[model samples]
Target: MAVEILIVDDDPLIRQTLHQQLVALGYSPHVAEDRRSAEQQLARQEFALVILDLALPDTSGLALLKHWQEAGTSLPTIMISGTATIPDAVEALKLGAADFLVKPVDMFLLEATLKRVLAAQALRSENTRLKQLTRGGRVDFLGDSPCIRELLAQAERVAATEQTVLVEGETGTGKQVLARWIHARSGRADEPLLAVNCAAITETLFESELFGHEKGAFTGAGERKPGKLELVGRGTLFLDEVGELPLLCQAKLLTAVEDRVFERVGGTRQMRFEGRIIAATNRILSQEIGKGGFRRDLYYRLSAFAMRLPALREHADDIPLYIGQALERCRRQYGRTFEPPDDNTLRQLKANSWPGNVRELYHHVERIALLTDGPRIPRSLWLSFPTEPESEPTDIPTGDLRTAMTGFKRKYIQRVLARCGGNQTEAARQLGIERTHLNHLLAEYDGRR
Candidate 1:
């Protein structure tokens, strides 16, 4: 689909210039001469990008930007003005403009900026779509263990309400998945479910990430941006690793959790967060509060309804079922079939401590599927599966399989490529995969590295 861009400017010359340039660049362009017309266009159509003149005759472009911000519009925008000052540019950005341009907008610079912004928006949209696709088929709770049943019951009880929920579990125990299950059952299931990894984002970026920022809020904040909270709208915002949020952020978040209100980083206009907040943390927050690392009040606010996910060890009986499910998923994912693990293999899997819980088990299953050439996974591969050290049998590896696999694959592929003297074709041949597949893997590896 061609990207559609909305040009909101009173000047006919500027509109014509931008429309021609957008057409040259293979985008569909629509024009609105004033704020009223712009509003009508926005209401009637979905635009991938908006070019607004700050000096609209009917109303200030900044006002329109503010309206979109408050209304939770996700449209990316570029602000243009013939009489724009630094403050005007900054204010426009603070209102969620994607870019700001002075009048006599240099065609080259405008095209470049539009491309950059559009590319970023496309990437974000793709990521969200992939996440939803991966999540779409696997909404059921996998195990029938007692603890699993109780967790589902508790989730059902909470899904009917709008109260805040805190999910606690060991790392890789599927806390986020369970949270999604709750959201899927909630009244807001039809809306977006956005997850933010509080631990992955640094403290300095946390505020802008969660509450959003105005243009000029910081040194590199070129345009106004909506935070995750705003993007979630009336859906669910999953705060994964909520405990890792700094104390300062925690204090600010408390208000949103309690009242669902927050202002952008550089603006005073209070915005309403109509979405549900679901926070998950691997840490025992009570201990963090006692250690002065967390706020007791915030903890209280989040824990109005809490659900604890049991570790895989706590439900050993479910291991076989999980193995079967993992095998089926692998078969579908890789387009290959495999015999289920035999009795002896199941016994070893159950006996071994699954510190990484279900996640670890699934990866092991994938690895087995990748390595096996016959109907059954060789029992010898069992020895290659990672296990906890003898001294720390209960301690599992930290982090998700994606991170682990990325690191492992990057290193392994690099070594192979290096051995092949950086010859991609040779490396692919040795790796027993198509050259295009190798190139894709190499691109992903380099991106992560």
Candidate 2:
């Protein structure tokens, strides 16, 4: 990607010379003879830097600068003039011109100034990115559900091997927690566990984040920085929400996943990926592949040993355990404590479906703890907490049991589908029904829409 440089000057000779100079310096330069052409160019394209002759045929360069200022536009510009006075240079600088050069512009100085301004821009961009990106917190398992016990057993078996692992489930089902569990149990537990949030990263930053970049790879790249893949030596690279990875990155990652090797951005040197990859996603990749959103080859390569974490509702018996843990955490974090709920309160808590799984439960408990003044939280709060809505549709009559039963089944299936975020596969698994059966029922209910 060549850096675009816009040259606004009336001198054909100077424009041609500067164009050749910019090209020789590995830039793409566009020329405009006057202010009209310059404004047109600015409207049509994005330029990294603008070179403006102080004495344009139509207007003074300062007037163009004022136009930029009044239009609420701030373009990085370098002002050039054959007869540049000290006052003219000061005015250009005040108008946000990055630099002022006397005519017969020094190409070396131009290159150096370009690097300086671009480097400053990159630093500012990186600082802003760093502020936007936040590392997620980790929460380990703390439940006695048989579903979790089975998942643990499976994780242990997979942890013994060096094969890549993929964990799948609904949101808040402890996918990352399971990834951590696998990492801790694996042979490379001593090495650091590095992670990257696939969904949070912008596409431009994706490659540099995973495979690093050589110093001076791009205009503002500066010093070389090692990415997660390089940092997680012989350890685990936990790619969270990997289904959201951009197509370009998916192709880039295939080399690392399949060949166990990668190259830094703009560098020919190849590096071996000695670490294991444990990617987790809440998405159904099969559906994404059918929709052409995910690559089938990448999916196959990643799912060498795939596992699904059970939704919290599947293990309702563990609700008490989680509730108690949430209260204790609230105590530790905010110095708020509460009595253990009575059996009826426990029953109500268990009755509601926790659609967001353990994460939602913790937040719900914390909210109640923060607002309630007394040790005993009001039971009304528990009652108000959402439960699976009543599924009986009014159209069904009370006199006909067979027809009424059919309506109940349809409505119940619809409720469960909503709980599973409308994934027929997950909804079927949740309802303890075959996918074909769910599809068949959905076909009949489609007319009700």
Question: Which candidate achieves the best lDDT against the true structure?
Answer: 1
Q: What is the lDDT of residue 196 in candidate 2?
A: 87
Question: Model 1, residue 349: what's the lDDT?
Answer: 79
lDDT of 1 by residue, 1-449 (tens): 88899999989999999899889878999999998898898889899999988887878889888988999988899999888899998898788888898888887898789978986787568546634643455478788989999999999999999989999999989998898899888998867788999999988898899988887988999767788877777788999999999999899899888888998899889999999989999999998997899999999999999889999999988998888898888888878787877887778778878889899988888887888774677888854776556685443435898776677777778889988989999999988999999999878766865
Which stretches of candidate 1 lie above 4 Å from their native place?
A: 1-138, 387-449
Error of 1 at 226 (Å): 0.4
lDDT of 2 by residue, 342-439 (tens): 88988877877888988988888888888786588888775566556789855755758887787788888988988888899999999898999889
What are the lDDT figures for the candidates, one per model? 0.86, 0.85
- Where is model 2 more than 4 Å wrong at Cα? 1-140, 386-449
Error of 2 at 165 (Å): 0.8
